[model samples]
Target: METLIKKNQAEKQLGLGILIVVIGSVFLLRNSGIDIPRWILSWHTIMLGAGLWIGYRRNFQGGGWLALTIIGAIFTLKHIVVFDFELSRITTALVLIALGLYVILKPKKVTTFKNYGQANQSDFKDLNS
Candidate 1:
């Protein structure tokens, strides 16, 4: 339990440090007369970094936030280079297909109920009596 607490604290510290570095670098770039786009400097980037950090901190127990981070980063790539929207569309389609295949190929669990008929008959007889 103590080790877990320490690990959580370490993660928090690491996240904060990363946040500071990102913010500092943006400011540094601005001070150096680099014309960063408004969108790149917006809250969206911050949120994406936060989501990625949180996902990592939690060891990716749930994939929702991590997925959002990935998608958001992919979209943001357009700002850095020429990313065609068609690429994102293709990625989405591929993800859907992978999910469908996983669902189809995954094993199903079958539950068995033993002596259920006997239990029901006894209960029915008791009620009738």
Candidate 2:
């Protein structure tokens, strides 16, 4: 219970830190007269930021966030530059390839017993009886 509480506190601190940095940068950039797009404050930006935070904090196995980041980035890029390619098809193919590679390359865990049934064949005999 204590460990859980501590972990929760640490996460809260991390969230607070991220919030402060994001807010500070936004205000600072605005004050400096930089052209900040209104979309920066949009729901997409929130999702993107959440993805980045989760990816960094949880080391990418956190799911949804990584996908969110990828999709958000693709959409953001499309806005900046027109592309004639089938983006969804390409993205799907790439994701499938990545999954295949992970399945093929990920390490297999091996389990071993220091002593099988305490080296007693009676362990099995008792089960049979």
Candidate 3:
């Protein structure tokens, strides 16, 4: 268990280090007048990067990163594709659907009350005494 925890910590640190380096490199290149694509510097790309970083930090077990990634992807796609219908409405619907699915499918945590009855009985006995 101790070794596993150390390994996970190391992995998380490595991920953060790599992310920082990549972000720094991008900024450096931009400042040097290297013409990077506009899309790569867009808000959607930032959202995607944030999602990936969060996912890496959490070992991808949590859904928060998934939500950010999906939202970013949807917006990015909207920019890339010329759809006839309203994409905002579709995005809202998709968000609702995903939320519903997550609520229904998420794992339930089981909580156990240990020695509750015995504790209550002891308390009653003490009160009477």
Best-to-worst order by TM-score is 1, 2, 3
Question: Residues 17-63, candidate 1, lDDT per residue (tens digit)?
Answer: 88789779988998899987665676556666766777666765565
For model 3, the stretches where C-alpha displacement exceeds 4 angstroms are: 53-62, 78-129
Candidate 3 lDDT tens digits, 1-129:
999999989987887898789878988998999976566668997897788778767766678998898778677645543356655556767767866886787667778888757755644576677
TM-score for each model: 0.53, 0.52, 0.51
Candidate lDDT values, in order: 0.67, 0.69, 0.75
How would you encode candidate 2's per-residue C-alpha lDDT over 2-85 as one tens digit per residue?
999999899979898989998789878988999776657667666767777777677566457668876665554433322556
Model 2 pairs in collision: none
Error of 2 at 34 (Å): 2.4
By lDDT: ranked, best first: 3, 2, 1
Error of 3 at 129 (Å): 40
